[model samples]
Target: MRCLKMLVIAAVLMFGLTSCGVTNHMISNYNVSQTQLVLSKDNFRVIGDVEGRARATYVFGIGGLSRKAVRENAIADMYRNARLTGAQAVNNITTTVKVRSYPFVMEYEFIASGQIIEFTGE
Candidate 1:
């Protein structure tokens, strides 16, 4: 009976830790800036490459993890990083998702990358 109780407690603790989704520290440390720019013209010149990543976890499909949320977060992170470098736009954006599963827990990571650009207006 004691062994069974211990097992139950351990399982609950693991679930609690894994269900918290992404951490605030991870999101806050990206140092993304809030700036808007138009990325639809050839006048923009490439400054450099930038990337963002976010993670979500699911346990027996109980967690409210969604691909849309992961994707949005990744893009937001990318934009923030770009803006910090004084970039006026981002282009050639690409997104990728990776999945890892272990018995009851499944984790997904979304990554976004793009080239930072500035409008030359030639």
Candidate 2:
């Protein structure tokens, strides 16, 4: 039946899309750098915070994934990427993930360049 065929195609498409994972590559590169720093650091701490960016947000297909899953993935990636750059936490740090959609598939980008800040405790 036509309905059955459509269902099969939809299932395949969803599976392929979800398997693609999060679209936070800039963050991924950062993670690489952060990891490198961690290897050389005498002390390390993990910080979490959120901020907004001027650029249009990015949105990837949710598929069956929850928003929490997506955000967490991005945050973890941000931490890993920051480590690659040799930037250890001076105090605390925050990175923002912006989600926006276009005509085609949604995009999920890390708007962390200017949004990140080094925390200093008094």
Candidate 3:
């Protein structure tokens, strides 16, 4: 009976942890400038730095998580953050992925960061 109770407790704990969904992070200023272009570093003048991240957790490796999905979500978040900074565009974009593993679960985060910029017609 004691063994059965311990097993149940462990199962509940695992379930609780797995059910936790994605986490996100962002840093930006509220006074954003409106613009219609997503530019590269060479095409724009960087005004400030912006960052965004998204995380997804998998239980027993069962969730159909894909890199493309994660990356897209992170990029979307970055764009939103850029808008918050009133950027005309985002430049110098960089992306990274982090994974953590436990006995029966894994958590991964997709992180995207970039510099907010304006057009420099040089």
Q: Which candidate is the best by TM-score?
A: 1
lDDT of 2 by residue, 1-122 (tens): 99999999999887766623344423333333243233354444445344333222333543434554555555555444554333434122334555555444554544444223332232
Compare candidates 2 and 3 on lDDT and give the better one: 3
Per-residue alpha-carbon lDDT of model 3 for 75-100, expressed as tens digits? Answer: 78988877643326775566777776
lDDT of 1 by residue, 2-114 (tens): 99999999998887665324422223223233434555656566689999988888888768458778877988888778764443667667777777666578788888887
What are the per-model numbers of colliding residue pairs? Answer: 0, 21, 3
What clash pairs does model 1 have? none
Q: For each candidate, what TM-score against the reference?
A: 0.61, 0.30, 0.58
Measured with C-alpha atoms, the lDDT of residue 14 in candidate 1 is 89
Candidate 1 lDDT (Cα, 0 to 1): 0.70
Model 2 segments more than 4 A misplaced: 1-64, 84-90, 103-105, 112-122
What's the CA RMSD for each of the models? 9.5, 11.4, 8.7
Worst 10-residue lDDT window for candidate 2 reads 113-122
TM-score, model 3 to reference: 0.58
TM-score, candidate 2, is 0.30
